[model samples]
Target: MTIGVNCGHTLHGAGSGAEGLFREAEHTRLVGQALVDLLKEAGIYVADCTIDKADTCQEYLAKVVSFANREDLDWFISIHFNASASHKGKGVEIYTYKGKQYPQAKAICEEMAKLGFENRGVKEGSGLYVIRKTRAKAMLVEVCFCDNQQDVDTYYKIGAARAVSQIIFNSICGQCRQGENEKSPGRVQEKSKEQTTFMEFVGAIARKDWKERRIMLPSVVTAQAIKESAWGTSELACKANALFGIKENGWKGRIYIKEAIEQKPDGSYYKVDDTRWRAYDNWEQSILDHNNYIATRSTDGGRSLRYGAVIGCCDPELVCWYLQRCGYATSITYAESLMKDYVVKYDLTVYDKP
Candidate 1:
């Protein structure tokens, strides 16, 4: 089956997202990406219909629909998180275009409710832009409320991204692992169960950093620390308590010496030993310094913030997006790696508390 999946909203700005305890735009991307990964693993043809850039909501809706329409899709799914001004919502809901019926839609609600979220059931979404405009059968999933702490807590409890993706996968794949593609890696590779200890340990530090400094989301900091340092096992991280690979262009504090890999303009990589990296007194200091870099570093001789868009941002996806845009990392998939491989897989956004 061919499906078009859209991660709702832009990274930030015009069609950004709803902001409450967490970010709507970001979590949608997390869920959508996970779902896409699952469907593809089952040997299903998939089209990512997400449009991350738009000048207005109309543009966002139109672009996404146009992209999906271009594909000969049998199904189109738009993933989103719920939000209420009163912060009273704590449920899972799905919407189908008026007069349309999808058995999978009801199935997804029932399956998700098994994870402790109230089953809000299926509803009509006639006026929804994506639903009305898309050529294929469409459903919009509001996984849970972003503004409600109880809902967010429940979402993290069951691994929102994976649970939602798996439920959707079961609805479509139905005991069929992969259709005629046995060699395709179909099973979702879960994280090491042993990583829980390290996550809770470093999570406390990142949570403290967010609670005290209000600088960056705890999930982003914690994910960076985990991915970059191999859960605090890297020699540089152990010896100096540093996690970020931020170079030492102008440093006055202690430095950690290590071999650094650099990518040349011609897309070639070379290793250079004796490279200096900023070191800290502890992991807390390491996180603090990283946040300091995001807040303080500038290119116009300190006249303006180089990564001003990321300051105080709660959306890990948008934060990473802005950081990558501002030349924070060399990989073109920097935001993708941080979101899919770290934040969503580990359910780290639970740390993005109020």
Candidate 2:
């Protein structure tokens, strides 16, 4: 198959991609180049039809279309990131020319959603210049919202450029199958077990980095991860890679908006739909950021450490006590719950050393 891939927008000046947690133009180039290489690897002819230095938006669009028209291509793809007025629009959406159906677009959207991005599905591009003007069968991909911090976090978590390229490539060329010569049911179950043990994966990552990152007491950290992330099955954990219930306040990184159940001081629970939590690229980063939050969090405008009592504590239970007393969680029995439910139940303190 011969194809033309256009990384939409310019690097700078007019027609630049959206700017939010990341630069859309830069990512477009990254993804576009990645796609070009992947298709070539699959023995398909590909052309990079990007026009990055146009004087104006109109010129940029015209040049890309003109370049694409010149190529003897079977398919044309334009990659872009969307933006919203509230800086919170999220998800992956693919577009085809008006009244046109491209199965590749549908497949790509489904593949992206598997990485935890919301699937906005394939839509008709009624007036898009790239989709409308291209001579070949055209599709434009809005690979998540640039201004949405939640989407940005997921983008990097799934390896950004490489993930996007692979999804698009696999959608068009079929996923590369490995180790699958029709596996037996027992083997399938074993693989499923391996994939489902992600909590252990997070534990291994936390243990490996706690000392180097200067985070003390992996026992408490692990317990907190278990309690907060619900053994790695919580929506926040699965979707945002957020281990702790860390809020988005004062966080410079991306944010995920999730509907969470907030506990009251009276032991009652309330539901909140717009809770903003910090998002990370992976569980390791989530653990590191949680450590930072613990070390630097303060109540009196950074004048005093909120959880200072446990800074250098050697006892795991003591650290939990300090966290509970310091208002780390809203649960009335937060410390007790972490201790009895996770730390002791799972013998987590054994991982505190080395």
Candidate 3:
């Protein structure tokens, strides 16, 4: 059966997020991309309805709904991360439009809980923009909280992105003996078992130096590194060890020049001249620079007073919002996008505490 997979929110524009330990947009993209790949591999006709840009939240939601409706797909799934002001909220929740629970939604949530997340159960999402507007059977999956450490650990430990993808694939394809479906159940169980050691190793390394610094939240630092450096895959990150994209404002060290996007006076973005970004000797150095960058910005000229509002803030959503207000980035929804798309979805905040 054909289905429309929407990664929920714009990849780079307005109405893009709700942040926590990681940005919602990034996590949704990662999971949505993986879901699409898995579905395609299983020979299901899939339409990727992710929006690259839109002027407003309404426009963005409309565009996604329109795309799915226009395709006349059998089902639509919007992937998202859940967030709460408390930062203690945890688990997986699925929302279908007002009345009844769709079997698919229930099934997806049940399968997701198999990955060790709390099953928050299916609920009626009456006023939700996307849930109410879509023509086909649509469900929004709030995978887990970005701010909860235990949830974050579980997300990585179970490989939620791939696991969710496999669940969707199995739900749609049923018990058919196709190549993609063969031994799927066993494989998912195997992946869950194998991911533990790797998850702990990665978490320990990411948390080590950040814990020593005791400056910004380690989850926030790691989230920014993942977003800015494309998880160490960007040219600046790999070649120069510049994980946080620190610019050469007054740096005396080596610099790397690259074309970068700049927002203009009229809110339009343009490619400016090759910008000089700070180059570090190693990944740890880059992390140290990131810490110093925020610390200096907060303390320089009484700026620390303003930064103090969010310093040691455990809420990823609040942390990101304050960072944006402090002019950390140009995007208006940068914080929300980060919290919703990356932090919460990927459980990046696990690094925040220990």
Candidate 4:
């Protein structure tokens, strides 16, 4: 089946980057190209509707349907990063017209969410031109909230766009037989339950750096670390020596506070305990515990578990595996984008000392 990918209006360089809105059209263009490559790799035909980028939702979306209809494609998929009036809201949402084919739209949404994103729930669009006008089965996928920093830092920055494309490619065409045929035996091996500690787990997979590790670990432990420690400034990392953030369900641990405040509905500022966190004995244990979490969760699981399982077999690439495994990230492309940034930000290649 042929798939047309539309990068939302942000690509037309409409929004001002200074306002933090229209800054990523260039990146969105890259995202569109990435989707084309991914779809092609899956033995499917791809059309880029985002060519030359449009300014508004209406203009960009018009190009999307025009390209799809022109190609007589099977379906059109519009890729968009979402934003909310309130920054607290984040996650993935898919929209379809009110018709018999809504199930397929939901399937696409659910499959993408399998990357561990919050499900904003699928909705029926009314006036949205792409949803209303596309002759082929179409869905507008909002990968995550662009306005939310945590989502941006975690998923959007990490490559949620590409992750969503892979999911879309998988959902529309099924597993790419070539990818299946290309699977290398023993590419992914389960760790023994005994080696459940965090440091040992990372050390065990040390040969697999971010490049090699995305295939093995699927995603680096950075997300887990940031999620657990509130971006390294947490007491768990600064005080307790816990570099990898691993929160357990029923473990005895200390709680520390950093210091922050919150505004109440009454319009009063309250010294809401700024620093509340879990403490571990040391960083090594934290790393081991993190591994335990991945092993148990086993990426891209749930009703879409089969999809994740297939990717584990076929793509063996850690970031892809992680996307399939986690399947619920707010930013569908979180890990991949993050790895790109990590390599640039930390000069991580220098750390590869023998």
Q: For model 3, what is the alpha-carbon lDDT of residue 79?
A: 89
Per-residue lDDT tens digits of candidate 1, residues 59-92?
9999999989998888999988888878897898
In candidate 3 the C-alpha lDDT for residue 248 amounts to 87
lDDT of 3: 0.71
Candidate 2 lDDT: 0.77
Better structure of 1 and 2 per TM-score: 1
Worst 10 residues of 4 by lDDT: 186-195
**Which sections of candidate 3 miss by over 4 Å?**
175-354
Report the C-alpha displacement of residue 155, candidate 4, in angstroms: 0.9
lDDT of 4: 0.51
Q: 289-346, model 2: which lDDT tens digit per residue?
A: 8877878888799899887886767788888888888888776777876776566756
Q: Report how far off residue 146 is in candidate 1 (Å).
A: 0.7
lDDT of 4 by residue, 119-231 (tens): 77777664678878888777777766767777676665445555655566666666543244256322332222432243234434432443443222323454344333434
Model 4 stretches astray by more than 4 angstroms: 10-24, 53-59, 99-104, 156-159, 176-354
Model 2 lDDT-worst window of ten: 177-186
